[model samples]
Target chain A: EDQVTQSPEALRLQEGESSSLNCSYTVSGLRGLFWYRQDPGKGPEFLFTLYSAGEEKEKERLKATLTKKESFLHITAPKPEDSATYLCAVQVGGGKLIFGQGTELSVKP
Target chain B: DTAVSQTPKYLVTQMGNDKSIKCEQNLGHDTMYWYKQDSKKFLKIMFSYNNKELIINETVPNRFSPKSPDKAHLNLHINSLELGDSAVYFCASSQQRQKGEKLFFGSGTQLSVL
Candidate 1:
């Protein structure tokens, strides 16, 4: 069965703290991996898309790196406003995205 | 202007009642989708339409139906709503049905079944 799992279900960090969220997957015919940021009571916002191993993308304080079996979303000196649930999804055949349970991060100022 | 939008930000109802959630996207995208987020905040895809044609339909209940009246509009209707149906339903769109395309989502509709 194809599956995606994210580690650290919940995280509390002080402002300027750094951390990394993990998303491990086991699936067949992997097409892409995606990252999204979702706030409370709102829909998810697009962040980045990784197509293959060793691919990396960065925006602001967030950087996403992908490997053969897992992906990491590294937060460098996060701020309060940067606190949100980060979601990871893997695209398989037919463009279907299998999502993992998101990691909720709370950054206190 | 909002790129993608859904109606009824919140819907509270009793079990067995039927309701509909409407969605529209102005991004000129060729594809639209419906995703459900449960209490654990795990998102799962329900249905997807490309240019008003159903392309992907997951193993969802038959009581749930998705209608795409046009290329830009997709609506979800639930019949005989159950208590387990309470969740946030999100409407999303993308440029195409090809791989590696990022989706643009709307402010989800929170559904509560009492």
Candidate 2:
């Protein structure tokens, strides 16, 4: 069975605080790993896609790194506007995506 | 412009009723998908259509059916809705059915089955 797990279901950080969210997966064959940010009452917004181990991508204040069995989303100097639920998904051999339960992040000002 | 759009941003109804959620994409993508987000905030892929053809269907109940009239549109119809069916449904599209393509998503439709 293919499964994705995200650690630290919820996190609270003061403005400018930096931290990393973890996404670990178990699948037969890894095809891709995706990161998304979802605001309250809205769908997820695409962030980054990592295809192989040691791959990393960055956008603004967010950086995503992927490994053989897990991925990490690191937030740097986060602002209150950056508060959102971060989701991680893994694509297996098939084209479908298996998503992990998101991490709710709160950047208090 | 909104890349992907879904109708009925919020729907609340009784169990046993039937309803449908419509989704359309203006991104000129050939592949579209439907995903359900439970209360636990876990998103699960329910169906995938490529060029109006069903490409992937997960373990969703038969009551949940997806219709894609064209590559730009995909709708989800639910029959005999149950309380467990309450969740947010998201519509998304990608340029193609590639393994690592980025998906553009619409604001989800929140369904409440009482």
Candidate 3:
């Protein structure tokens, strides 16, 4: 069965702290991996899309790196406004995108 | 302007009642999708429409039906709503021809069934 799992269901960090979130997948044919940031009472906002292994993408304070079996979203000196649930999804055959339980990050100022 | 938008931002109803959530995307995308997020914040795809055609339907209950009246509109109707059906339903869109393109999501509709 194709599955995506994210580690650290919840993360609490002080402002300007750094951390990393993990997303591991076990799909037969991996077409793409996407990262999204969702805030409370709002929909998810697209962050980055990693297509193959060793691919990395960055925006502002967040950087996403993908590998053969897992992906990592690294936060460098995050701020309170940067706190949100980060979602990871893997695209499978027929354009089916499977999502993992998101990691809720809370940065306290 | 909103790229993707859904109506009835909040829906509260009793069990066994029927309701519908409407969605529209102005991004000119070829594909639209419905995803459900449970209390645990786990998102799961329910249905997908590509160019107004049903393309992907996950293991969802028959009571949950998706209708695409046109290329830019996809609505989800639930019959005999149950308490377990309470969740945030999100509408999303993407270009099917553009492989690996990021999906644009709308502000989710929060459904609460008592």
Q: Arrange candidates by TM-score, descending.
A: 1, 3, 2
- What RMSD does model 3 have? 0.9
Superposed Cα deviation of residue A91, candidate 2 (Å)? 1.3
Docking class of 1: high
- lDDT of each residue in B1-114, candidate 1, tens digit only: 999999999999999999999999999999999999999999999999998999999999999999999999999999999999999999999998688998999999999999
Tens digit per residue, CA lDDT, model 2, B1-114: 888999999999999999999999999999999999999999999999999999899899999999998999999999999999999999999898778988898999999999
Runs of candidate 3 with Cα error greater than 4 angstroms are: none
lDDT of 1 by residue, A1-109 (tens): 9999998999999999999999999999888999999999999999999999999999999999999999999999999999999999999876688999999999999
Task: For each candidate, give its TM-score against the true structure.
Answer: 0.99, 0.97, 0.98
Better model by lDDT: candidate 1 vs candidate 2? 1
Q: Which candidate achieves the best DockQ against the true structure?
A: 1
Best prediction by TM-score? 1
Tell me the tens digit of each residue's lDDT in model 2 across A1-109.
Answer: 9999998999999999999999999998787899999999888998999999999999999999998989999999999999999999998754788999999999999
Error of 1 at B27 (Å): 0.4
Q: What is the Cα-based lDDT of residue B114 in candidate 1? A: 100
